[model samples]
Target: MKRTWFTHPEPLDTTTANELIQRYTSRQIQTKKTLAFDPKFWLVSALLPEYRHEPKPSKQYQNSIWSQ
Candidate 1:
């Protein structure tokens, strides 16, 4: 099945985005009971000015943290 986020181009409203962010930060998956990673953490954090800090690791770093 195609992902809604991919099939649709509209960005989520602030309220929805914040809810998703909170769910991720708290490690509470509202959609399902199983724990899963949320890629939106970085995306939403980046849009907010207060979330300043070192950026998330790149794909290369994610693949091999010890190599570089």
Candidate 2:
């Protein structure tokens, strides 16, 4: 990816590049962590008989999980 991107003439300044890399790395790390409030997990739980009363999947619910 870096090699291909290097083919482009436009270059990001050092501070901007570092900030971008940092944000990307932070997101990658966050995605790797287990999130208890994740809506997808709750949806599966809701499907189970024991958790039938759990809230249904909605845009707000899913977004809440991913936004973390």
Candidate 3:
């Protein structure tokens, strides 16, 4: 099986990046597989601050998650 990882080009604060890394890593472990993330994931998570829900797979999820 293939594994995926996501990151951003823009610089990130140490704390936030660490948090994201931890979250992604945990997901990888829970799924027993590697996960892929796109630039949009990073942008949405970082800029919006509302997309912390698991099993979220929609633009509304994106909007709601970031809205916070």
Best-matching candidate per lDDT: 3
What lDDT does each candidate get? 0.41, 0.35, 0.43
User: Each model's TM-score, in the order given?
Assistant: 0.28, 0.28, 0.34
Clashes of each: 0, 0, 4
Q: How do all the candidates rank in terms of TM-score, highest first?
A: 3, 2, 1
Which parts of model 2 are misplaced by more than 4 Å?
A: 1-9, 29-68
Query: Residue-wise lDDT of candidate 2 within 1-68, one digit each (tens)?
Result: 11111111234444544454566466552111122343232111111123335576777546666788
* Model 3: how far residue 41 lies from native, Å: 18
Give the top-scoring candidate (TM-score): 3
Better of 1 and 3 by TM-score: 3
Q: Write the per-residue lDDT of candidate 1 for residues 1-68, one digit (tens) a residue.
A: 22222111234554666676677557642231212245332233322223445678667535465658
Q: How close to the true structure is residue 53 of candidate 1, measured as C-alpha lDDT?
A: 58
Task: Give the local distance difference test score of model 2.
Answer: 0.35
* Model with the higher lDDT, candidate 2 or 3: 3
